[model samples]
Target: MTKQQVNKVVLAYSGGLDTSAIVPWLKENYNCEVVAFVADVGQGADELAGVEEKAIASGASSCYVVDLKAQLVNDVIVPTLKTGALYEGQYLLGTAVARPVIAAAQVEIARKVGADALAHGCTGKGNDQVRFEAAFAALAPDLQVIAPWREWHLTSRPQLLAYLEERGIPCSASITKIYSRDANLWHISTEGGELEDPWNAPSSQVWCWTTEPEQAPDTAEHLSLSFHQGEWVGLNGEAIDPVSAIDTLNQIAGAHGVGRLDMVENRLVGMKSRGCYETPAGAVLYAALQGLESLVLDRSSQDYRIRLGHEFAQLLYDGRWFTPLREVMQVAAEKLAEPLTGEVVLKLYKGQITLTQKQSPNSLYSSAFATFDEDDVYHQHHAEGFIRLYSLASRIRALQQASATDPQSGGTS
Candidate 1:
């Protein structure tokens, strides 16, 4: 795309250091009017505060802050929960899933404001650049996508800071903050600093939304969670809103140090990066949902659900949220989730949530069939015939080996 033809550009801005620097960089390089777009996916009030002023001060013509918290939880998070999708078996894909929604919103804002180009602060080396670009390509193919990080001379944080400082852009950030952190209603992730090394343990400062295991209280807490068609509706029998329900779980689980993970995951850009994440609410919710699944789902159905969960996790992690595959997986997950209505009682201890009990109307577990005591429901001798058939191939292989080794047996036996 030619810079002379571009008049205006809409940016997916977070009011962060990179984004703040990108605003002025776009104006200087492309010579286009930059409009900043911020999506509020429950990161925090402090992050959202003074965003408009920050954008305008950073050389943006106008700033649009769209509230996406409700939509995020209801539309994206809940559907993902239905599949029990966890990226690499640990991450909740908080940042990964949020990108598509943010990008989609930016495209919408660009269309509304009559912008000719879309810009993002994602670096060329990261997974986010692929995610954002793929989303823009899928949603707004006509709009020229501008990635300053890929094109600009500004490389490191110090260089960007220097540029911003030279422009007299007042930012409330400093180099003293060691770790790069991202937080939403679901989870908080930390990268950089000590986390750069895989051997180094995560320090106390690494966690923001959750308490350290050692710092947690000794007393255990019991809470009941109720779900209907995969959506959580109540806590301890009290009906609550989605935000409040998740918030309550976070407080309850975080107090017990229930969710903390450290992993080096493969990025979409074919590089590995280490990150420490705290997902208290998400952990508790996953445990409760699995407990409900145990009660409701049959053997074959449960196996399929597990497979779908893995696929869904990969899709979400790879930022394929708006695609047909995502829609199909979500539909299947929703169908499976229909019988998942139930209540689960979980005991939250130091960094552990044990499912104490689970009850569902559609439960397949039968007390009579599971009893160890003598009952007419199951015959004790039935296992003998079943075991013989199950191990027939193994037994036949052993017999063949014995016959071949025998002195009296022929070589062709």
Candidate 2:
């Protein structure tokens, strides 16, 4: 494997500074034809606009801009909601979960164009390299993977800029750019810059998707979310697909600054990194579904699902979505989600989404059984027998101790 045997490569292009430089570098180093593939996972129109032109300008033979937003929301996001997967209890695994879908699409594009290899602009220390390469291995093991950052000698932003400049490549980015960001339909994550220092607070410049909590409106906004068999089919009583539903929630929740998190998280590559994330719509959805789970699932069932949810979230963050363990977890979650049909009312105000109320058609809640007042349904006398049987082992242990102390009945016993 000293030298790859690929003649053509499909590179995941983002139209960003690194990827823009990667287009020409792939050709110059590998001596292969380069095709740029961009997956539109609803990062936004601004990022996608003129992306093809930029790719071509960077020396790509051709550019393929495919829309992946619908698939991302319907296939990935909707199914994930059923599992209640939240990374490390709060992170939401935003970029981690979104990577598989994007990488899968990139692989598909490579196959369609008959490329012998794949390329990505992910840095050496980032988790995305493992995610993208793992998918390539699972889907197309024969194809080679060329990771520029891991192979090239360019160490700094200045060096990368110099390489692009030497090749006469056009790039607007400068050394002043301090942050690395990834945006999609679910969330937007910001890293580098001041975030690298955990002691430093995330300045206003670090945030974009969410309004400042203090700047949020004084009034709270209430909304109704409807779900059928675990899928969020309609928002605000209006029928909509998963993609539109996410957008609608993002708009509403973003307005109130409902989702903002600044934390030091452990990366899959075994590094602790600090970052800020804004997941406005995802926050509202999680609060709603968790409440719905409490209504539909029994105590024991809910407990097990929650335990499994934690594991599922961890696996997702580690980029093991294609593994058998992940499949098993997903299957179990889907079975539990069958009874999750309900409506939840949420109150959003200043970065907080409160579950005001929730009702499920298959709700296991029964006020009669749980009432503290006198009720004919549950006989008081029945509890005496039940308690005796339940604590029989404890009762036996106490009787043995009493017998041992009765020295009068049996001397020196």
Predictions: Cα RMSD each: 1.9, 2.1
Those runs of model 1 whose alpha carbons end farther than 4 Å from true positions after fitting are: 373-377, 395-413
Instruction: Please give the lDDT score at residue 69 for candidate 1.
Output: 77
Sequence-dependent TM-score of model 1? 0.95
Top lDDT hit: 1
lDDT of 2 by residue, 1-413 (tens): 33446688999999988888888878878888999999998889999989999999999999999888888877778778889888888888789878888888888988899998899998888888988888888888988899999888887789888888998888878877889889998999999898888889899999988999899999999999898998887787888777867877888899899889998888888888888999999999889999999898988989988888899888888778778898888899999999999999999998888999899879988787778766877877889999999999999998888887789757355
Output the lDDT of residue 310, model 2. Answer: 91
Local distance difference test, candidate 1: 0.89
- Tens digit of per-residue lDDT, candidate 1, span 1-413: 89878899999989999999999888888899999999988888998999999999999999999988787788889999999898887888878867877888899999999999999888888888888888898999999999888898987778878999999998877856699888888888999999998989988889887788777888989999999988999998899899767877888899899888888999987999999888899999999999999999999999999999999999988878879999999999999999999899999888988999999999999888888877776878888999999999999999999988887887444
- Cα lDDT, all candidates: 0.89, 0.87
Candidate 2: residue 277 Cα off by (Å): 1.0
